[model samples]
Target: MDHWSSLSMGKNVLMERRERADAARNRQAILRAAEELLRRHPPEQVSVERVASAAGVGKGTVFHRFGSRTGLMLELMTERARELEQAVTEGPPPLGPGAGPAERLVAFFAAVAALAARNGNLMAAHEHAMVTRKSAAEQPREANPIYLFWHRHVSELIAERRPDVDAGQIAHMLLGTLHMEPVASQLRAGQYEGLAASFAAIVRGLMGEE
Candidate 1:
């Protein structure tokens, strides 16, 4: 159209793009800070000010970006959990489509074992916070999305492998039995090898095979 109209449209596009870019950058900063805190210490120990310092931003910026400490923790863990879930459900893996139940179960446990060993602090921190005070809504539901994802994945495996067995019960048992809490806690305290093997052995038993 006319030059004035074209200039106005161009200006609007530039402004929108700039806002999106800034939002992305701010998100990255917050996540980076959270990740750094996760590496050095648990989430419980990492305050908004600490995260702000780590992210090279103001405390106000962090709060404005994430709204609250819980909000920031959720954002951080959500990214990681969603990645793992997608990997199991959709990404290439023994857990991915086409793999047999036994293989998928084993693979899923293996992945959990690794995640636990690696992210023990983050897990413990979230747990400690949750226990100190329960939220009314529990917006995300059931501790964390990772556990729910694991429940679903393991149940599906059971359904495939042993149609006679109660998949729901199996899911519950696995949720309680081979969960990350105990294993990861032990791992955090420096019992890595045994816990890792124990996880594999447990998975083997679950599969009803050697």
Candidate 2:
């Protein structure tokens, strides 16, 4: 199983509990196998057959568990999301429900950027996965949970300050700047320290404040 590829909550929920449980167990086994392989072997050398054999299953189980190598990667992304959600939901103060919306918004993006930098391949993988699906049938995964989390905070913050402006659009605009890689790269290149200030100013401007 690819760590990030096959984690489809919606797809699994439809399964009978037994099937779901079995799938989950198999999924875990596959992930463990992949993790072990990653520690010892290069990714390209770790084939689906190798993964299945490591997990004590047939080669087809690899295909069933994750549609393909790409599916495996997507599962990994989902794992990352689950881990991040668990961290913020269970671990500490700044990330939990008690933080103010504006503060939370800042904390969220900085954390995401740091996570992206650490994972290094995550953003590129995500863009690839998303672009692939955009060409296929149906909506892309409601993949917004991570993105929406911050957008919601921005919306709430705007609502507090503006009362009348469309918090939705304002939230999109502010978070758009924060999460946009081009803007982030510019900020990282020492092009400006003003990005944060500019973000704040835009949010404030949306609220009709100077």
Candidate 3:
């Protein structure tokens, strides 16, 4: 190709790369801002304009990146869910690959409880929004990918230790105890006193002296 044409093509490629990098940076900023805002305030107060202002991006940029408020919240939920899943599947011991099933199960519940403690409001808001949308009404709480992953993980752990027991039912029961309302209630009542100890006790009972 001609020298001018080659230079123009190179410039275009560089511009595209820069644009992609900027978009990624903006996305991260928006997520961070949204997370911080949601942590400090309720979901109704966390508007796109507020998030955009906190993120230092134009309001239109937030919509352009996430399509809508519901879309943004779903993206955040997906990100947090995937991060927790990775920690349980691939990260350090107890929660990850290196520990025995019993130990891993204990760690798994603790991690899930912590996750719910941190993001329970955000998760509930996201679920409510999804349920409100006509197209998403059929997707129940059980259909949540994070919940599915947790259920399967707990069932596998139960199966490993108690082959004769009904692992799936027990798994659901264990997960129910870790639900946001229960955990929040426990926190309110005990001020998080012996939280780990309580989880250990439950784990022992569930795993049956293992």
Measured over all alpha carbons after superposition, the RMSD of each candidate to the real structure, in angstroms, is: 3.0, 10.2, 3.3
> lDDT of model 2 at residue 190?
42
The sequence of per-residue lDDT tens digits that candidate 1 reaches over residues 2-38 is 9999999999999999999988898898788778887
| Candidate 3 local lDDT, 1-210, one digit each (tens) | 999999999999999999999999999999999999887886767888999999999999998998777778878988988988998888999899888888998787777666665676676657555655445434555666777888999999989988999999988887776545766656433334356568778878877864
lDDT score of residue 140 within candidate 1: 42
Which stretches of model 1 miss by more than 4 angstroms? 58-60, 90-95, 132-135, 140-144, 177-181, 190-193
Q: Pick the candidate with the highest TM-score.
A: 1
Candidate 2 off by > 4 Å: 1-22, 32-59, 67-71, 87-91, 141-144, 175-210
Where's the lowest-lDDT run of ten residues in candidate 1? 132-141
Question: What TM-score, computed on C-alpha atoms, does each candidate reach?
Answer: 0.80, 0.56, 0.77
Please write out the lDDT profile of model 2 over residues 10-105, one tens digit for every residue. 456657677978888999998777656655664455567887889898888878878765566556656766766676667565555566555545
Instruction: Order the candidate numbers by TM-score, best to worst.
Output: 1, 3, 2
- Every candidate's lDDT: 0.72, 0.60, 0.79
